[model samples]
Every structure is written in structure tokens, then in C-alpha cells.
Target: MSSSAAPAAPSAIPSEVFEPPVLAEVVRSGFVEGHHRGSLVVLAADGSVELALGDPAAPVFPRSANKPMQAAAVLRAGLDLAGERLALAAASHSGEAFHLELVHTMLAEHGLTADDLRTPPDLPLDPAEAEAYLAAGRVRERITMNCSGKHAAMLAACALNGWDRAGYLDPAHPLQQLVHQVVEEAAGETVTAVGTDGCGAPLMAISLVGLARAFRGFVLAEPGTAERRVADAMRAHPAYVAGTRRPDTWLMRELPGTLSKMGAEAVQAVALADGRALAFKVDDGATRALGPVLARTLRLLGIDAPVVDRIGHAPLLGGAGEVGEIRATF
Candidate 1:
């Protein structure tokens, strides 16, 4: 059966709740005007819904949140890396100097070069790193792409599995086939659709519930498998996965068994040890709203602690430095 056709939404958690003004505002106003609608799906490890909001059955592109599943394909195909490296491969990084260096090192290990990467070049996400690169007059290359680690892992899988490296990014390639399978299995449902992502890789469309379930599976993975390895790597080297300043990395590091990934256009996914998976997409793609929503979700999950401390309780600020809190209603 096609993975996309599988039924995966848990029939629990009320669709609507009375929303207070503050919470309602956050959920309604969003980061961009008229595009703030979002869905949150939380699933226990046993596939029970702990909470849900908006259209739980709504189909959305997971974007880079699908990286770990893709990495699972690479691992299942015999690509090997240390836990730290594996975690980095599944990250949507900040393209910092160290992050780029690691990608280069992975390429070298596979006897490849930056020239082999097909991902478009971009300035580092870190302001300091971007300034440094500009000051040094260094031209950004494919190696500096935030998704380079993922691409490098894809190439390594191709090399290890004896698949064609040149077309590894193609959706029909053997590596991508493996990725599709892994995604299907992790999601516990078939992919609804496939589309080209910002980084030029295939993106999977799945329900918010499906995405949350998949992440829950990742966190609860048994030891010695690629899934567990990816999770371990992400927690151990959170800074390298994104940056110390990045919310995704910081949140993951602060929460002992929490695994989180940030995708393009303000998509964030988090999986907790208690078998709960949370996914949220900021409608307008306003990246600023992501942190507060994520923090709010974490709080709802009873994860307050150093995690909150590391994430900090600062209110979201508008462009004028005024407090711009999310007023989620229901």
C-alpha cells in the first residue's frame, strides 16, 4: 500500500477549547497578518492523543523536520557516522564555520568535494559568521548551505549502498526510495504528497498528527539503531546541530530527552520522552512567533525547568521592541 493512504490521526483530544484572549491572540495574530492559523498534535507513544488543536488532520509539508527520517534511510542503507555527526546530519543548521567544516569533513571522508553538492549557496544564518565571511571576502559555496550536512549524509548513503551518487537527490533514486520508505514507517502513515523543498530535496506532505507521531517514534527508539543514534547525537551536540543561540538547539539541549527540529518557514517539531510529539507551523512563516509558540507548547507538556531557563521566559518583542505576546484563544 502507498504510505500516503494509511490512516494515522488519533481520534482523541477535543478539536476546540475555550481560548483566553492572550492565547487566542497568539494563535490568531500569528507572525504574519492573516496567516497565523496552525495545528498542534500531541501523541503518546502508544498512539493516544494527549492534545490537539486546529485541523489535526490538516496536511502540511514537514520541510526539514523530515531530516531524521531521511537520515534513518541513510543509516538503514549502511551509512555510518558517530552519534554527534549523525545528529548534525539531521539538523537544519545555522551554517556556521564549524558546521561547514563538519560538512566538508564528511565529504572528504567520502572522497567528495563541495563542488559535488547541488544545494544552493547562502550566507551563514549566524550574523557573526556571515559578517566574518564577508569581512574575509570568502565566497559562500554549497558547503556553506544550511542543508549541506543532510546532503552530505545523502551522498554518503549513496556511496555506501553503491547507489548512483550523481542523481541521489532525484526523487526516483534508490536513496530517495529508501527515504520514502523510512518516512512512511516513521510516520506510521503513507505520505500524502511530495514536493520540492527550499533546499532542492524532496519534501513530504503529511498530517500534523502524523508528523508528531513520527517524532515521538524517534525519541522512543531503542538503542543501537540509527534512530536512537540520531536522537543521541542531536542532544549531545545541540550547539553543532544548529547553534547555541538557536532556540531549537537550546530547547533540545535543555530538555534531557526532548528532540526538536526547526524547518523552513517557521515549522517546529518536538518529541518528548513521555511519548508525546508536538508539531507547529506559523501560518505566515513569521519565524519570530515560532519560539513563543514552542515555549508555550513545552510548558503545556509540563517540561518547565532548565529547559525553560535555557529558553528563557522573555516575552516576544515586536520590531519597535514592544512586547508582542501570542494571544492564543483555543
Candidate 2:
């Protein structure tokens, strides 16, 4: 169920290739001079698309939004992670202290080290955590990077299966083959392109529709299976999934049974308990556009809570008070 070769060159295909429609507008001081182009898709429980915007079929690397699927792959590969550890496997954490501590525990429990991490050394993605680290006269480490959780789990998977922990990040590794198979099966589509991710793991290119389909597939998975285990762990430990004050964490908290994960390049995917799902990407890669777009899309899908409004849209700052906002054009 796996393909050895990369599908095609997603690197050559610019995100602007098909030129997705403007789904959001940036208004500053009452002027509408900028906008974001991207695609959005919502799939109903029966797998029929309830809504579609822009070129939904074009290839887009889902970034960390694909983590849950990747986690499922590790589950199938025989890692017995659950709760916070399992959630962390699918996390794009904000690099909080607890987050780093958990990462350390996982590696220590498995007899691995931060040296085992393949992701680059970097500062915390969480601003306060980064400032605090520097104030303590500490240097940036790979463990502080947001993707350390995912990397630790990859190492743990290697530890679990007695595979080559050294070359686990390689696309040719047996673990990654299982990852590709799980990703394609979850998306119900063949990956059309492949690229190395920011964290150095293989990233498969799937359409926005395919992305939504995958998230939907995850939450709707049957009880007591590997797929459901990933979702359950994430849902039960939202804090580990993205850390304090993050959208995915807050969304999961406020909505309960609803899963939200945002990726780099302004990609967002949310799935409901009933199996409805939405996936989108902003062509300009403005992460600020993510909140408003997802808020409006969820509202369109019948989630009308005020919390979504508060967290989903980005606010415009002024000297005294808010003056403008980034609003969904559609």
C-alpha cells in the first residue's frame, strides 16, 4: 500500500499555480487593499463535499496538519503511546516548559537523547518561553523546537520496533513507508507529490479536499482502533497537542469533540464529532488570515458559538482601540 517514489515535483508547482480565489480580505483603517487566495473544502459524514472553494484538487503540502495521520502510522508500527504522549506525537506544540519536559521524558524512557532528534535546533515558537530561556543564559536546543514532540515520537517508534534509530528520518526507512501508507489510506487518495518537511520528515502533497477527507476519516474512525486512539489521545490532552493559548488547544477545549490543527503556510483543518470536516490553505501564507477564515467557515458549517469568533479572527490593533480587522470575504 506504499509507493517508493515521490509522486511529482510539488516544489516546482508554486502555491499560486492555479490561483485560488480570494477567501479573505485584510482591511486596515477601512481600506481593502490586500487579500489572501486559497482553497477550502468541507466534507460531510458520507464523504460528499458540502462546500468547495478555489482549486480544491491542487496539490498542497499539509505541513504539520498531517501529524495525526503520521501518528496513526506510528501506532500501526507498534508504538504503544497514549494520552499526552500520544497527543504529543501529533502535536505542533508551542515549546512550553511542560512540553519540553515531556519530550525529555519520552526520550529518556526510550533510552534516547536530544541527539536523536532530526529536526534542527531552534528557539521556542512560544514567545514567552523563548524569552525566558534566553534570560536564563541558556542556548537554543533542538528540544526547544516546536516539532520536538513529533520527532521524539518518531524516535520512539524506532525504539519500539528496534529499527535503525539513526536513519529513521530517511524516507527510505521502514517506518516512513508505513507513514506513507497510513497517510494515503487516511486521505483516501494517492499522494501526488512528496517533499522533505521543515522538520526533515517526508511530507506528502495532497489536495485540500483530500486533507479534509483525512481529518474526517480520523475522528469518524471506529472505537478501539489505532486511528481512534490517535484522535482520543489528542482530544483528551489538547494542551499537549499545541500547548497553552494555542488555537488548536483552545478550540478543542471550547468545542469538545472538535479537533483543530493548524499547519505552516496558513493551512488549517478542523473535524467535528459527527464527521464533518473543513480544510483550507491561504496562498499568501499569511497565518493571520487563518483565524478569520476558519471562524467564518465553521460558522457557515453551523458552529455558531461566540468563542469561535474570539479565537478564529485576527484583530487589528490601533493606538487606543481596535480600528479594523481581517474578515472573510466569502
Candidate 3:
């Protein structure tokens, strides 16, 4: 995609606007006060700010929001997988049984094993799946970890480049170096800092605007490019992008020509084929807060498709039955 002009600075929010705030129900138990406390930036195809909220210039840790850029580095390094496989590599998945199976398949295809993955082990995100595993007397392995696909991709990159397979996740490793460069280029800014992610890999820090710009570029990327492949894979196989009944999967599957990805905490980013990018962060890092806010943001941007209605307006159930609904007031 062609680069757009730099976005203008965001407007300041008056204190009174936050005082008696217009509380929006972000989740069943949480409400986000009106006026974004972190930052939000919406850019047009030409890179001009169509909408700016909070500190668009503020540097924030995009976390897994940067995964596609990192995957781009793996692609540039000559890793061969594409399509659905590429999408799985960029996902923050729910560790469903099928997701775990694919991770193992990717590892085995490259003659690697779960023992090679450096990410910590965790129980499956689906409660039913976890119970099934326990009932079957299965032990959790790195293959079952949510980040297994990413690690598997790193291993594949190592195999392709003839690099050391062990310690591929090291920040100083060649794979990581390429990842850093790709992220910087995609975001159109240097990473200001680095930190370890919860999944035991390097995390990048870039401004929200930069993050938004990177996603916009991904959607507009040339066909067959790694970036484009990532977008296509995620969109084509939304189930693998997340898991069965996951919001990320539902949103992407429901909306055509839209790409959505979520990061740890409340970081959510979306890019449209029309050259628009939206990025938002909830100040409290409440995971549940993201769905409602994202629905509202898309609505404000005029994306009122049927899928948006289904995913964004999921009913809030009480003890008896349906109580209040999580509504987003534009």
C-alpha cells in the first residue's frame, strides 16, 4: 500500500468531559468512561488523520498487535509457509485442540518438536477442552501453548536459513534482528524500547499511530507478499486466526474486506481495504472492555454491517435470562 502523509497531533480532552462521563458498557461488569484515556488514531489511505482521539503521538506498547510485522520479517527471511499457515503464525489464538494440532503439524513439517519451542506451557483457553485433556490424562506441552505457532514459525525460519535451531527466541538471534527491522519498517518508526511478552518473547514499543499505519499497510499490501498473505490467511481461515466462537474469528469472518487483531490487555487494531486504520487501548487493560469499544469505533467509522451487529451487540445474560445489553453509543 502507498504511504499516507503523517497524521496531525490529536486534540486534547477537557477534564469536564471525563468528570461526569458518558459511561459505555464495554462488558458485562465493566464500563469505559467516555473520552479515550489512552490513545486512538484513524488514518485515511493517504495517511491523513480522519479522526484523532487522545494522544495519537503517544508511544504505547502495541504488544501482539505487532505480530504481523514480525511475521513479515520471517517471510523476508525466506520462510516458505503462506495462506492459512501464515495467518496462524500471526494469531493470538485460544489454544483449541485443532490449533494445537496445527502447531504440531507445522513443527513436524520442519522436523522439529515441541521441545524446541521456548514459550511456556499453559492450559487450553477453552474450559471444555482443558477438561477433556485432563480426562484423557494428557500433559500440557509447548505445542498446546497459545504462542506455539509463532515459535514454530521461528523454528521454520531457522531451518530455512540454516541458523541455530536452539535458542531461536533469543532477542540477539538473527531471526529476532530481522523481526525488529521489519517491525520498524512496517510501523514507519524505530522501536523505542523492548520488553519480554507474557509468552516469553520480545515485545516491541511503538506509537499508536505507527501501529495503525502498519496494519493499514498490511491490508493494502501486494498480493503474494508475506504481509498480504498474513492478511489473507487470517481473513480466509478466521477459525484458525482465533478459535471456535472467538470474537476475533467472528468479527473477521462476518466482515468482508476487514482485518482485525487483538493483543494482550485491551489493545485492538483493525484495518480496512479503503485505506483506513483504527487503533485503540483501554487505560485499565481490561480485556473484556475491548469488544464493545471496538464495535462502537467501527460504528462511528460507518461500518454498520450485519456482522458488526452480531458480534458487537452480543447479549448480556443475567441469572434468569437476558438482562441489559452491552450497547455502544456512537
Compute each candidate's TM-score over C-alphas.
0.85, 0.93, 0.86
Task: List per-prediction Cα lDDT, in the order shown.
Answer: 0.77, 0.89, 0.78
Q: Is candidate 1 or candidate 3 better by lDDT?
A: 3
Over the full model, what C-alpha lDDT does candidate 1 score relative to the true structure? 0.77
What global local distance difference test value does model 3 have?
0.78
What's the alpha carbon RMSD for model 3?
10.4
C-alpha positional error of residue 65 in candidate 1 after TM-score superposition, expressed in Å: 0.5
Candidate 2 residue-wise lDDT, 62-111, digit = tens: 99999999899888988889999999999999889889999999999999
Order of candidate numbers by TM-score, starting with the best: 2, 3, 1
- Residue-level lDDT tens digits of model 3 in 68-140: 8877888888988776688888877777877888888998998998888988887776677778877889887
Candidate 3 residue-wise lDDT at 7: 100
Among these predictions, the greatest lDDT belongs to 2
Weakest 10 consecutive residues of candidate 2 by summed lDDT: 9-18
Tens digits of per-residue lDDT for model 1, 1-330: 655677888879888884312222432224623225566777766778877776767678888889988888888888888666787788778877678888888999998888888888888877777888889998877777788898998988787777888888799998888888888888888888999998888888887788888888888889887788887788788877788678878777767887888888767888887778888776667666576667777777777676664453435556756444553344
Q: In angstroms, how far off is 196's CA in candidate 2?
A: 1.0
lDDT of 2 at 307: 74
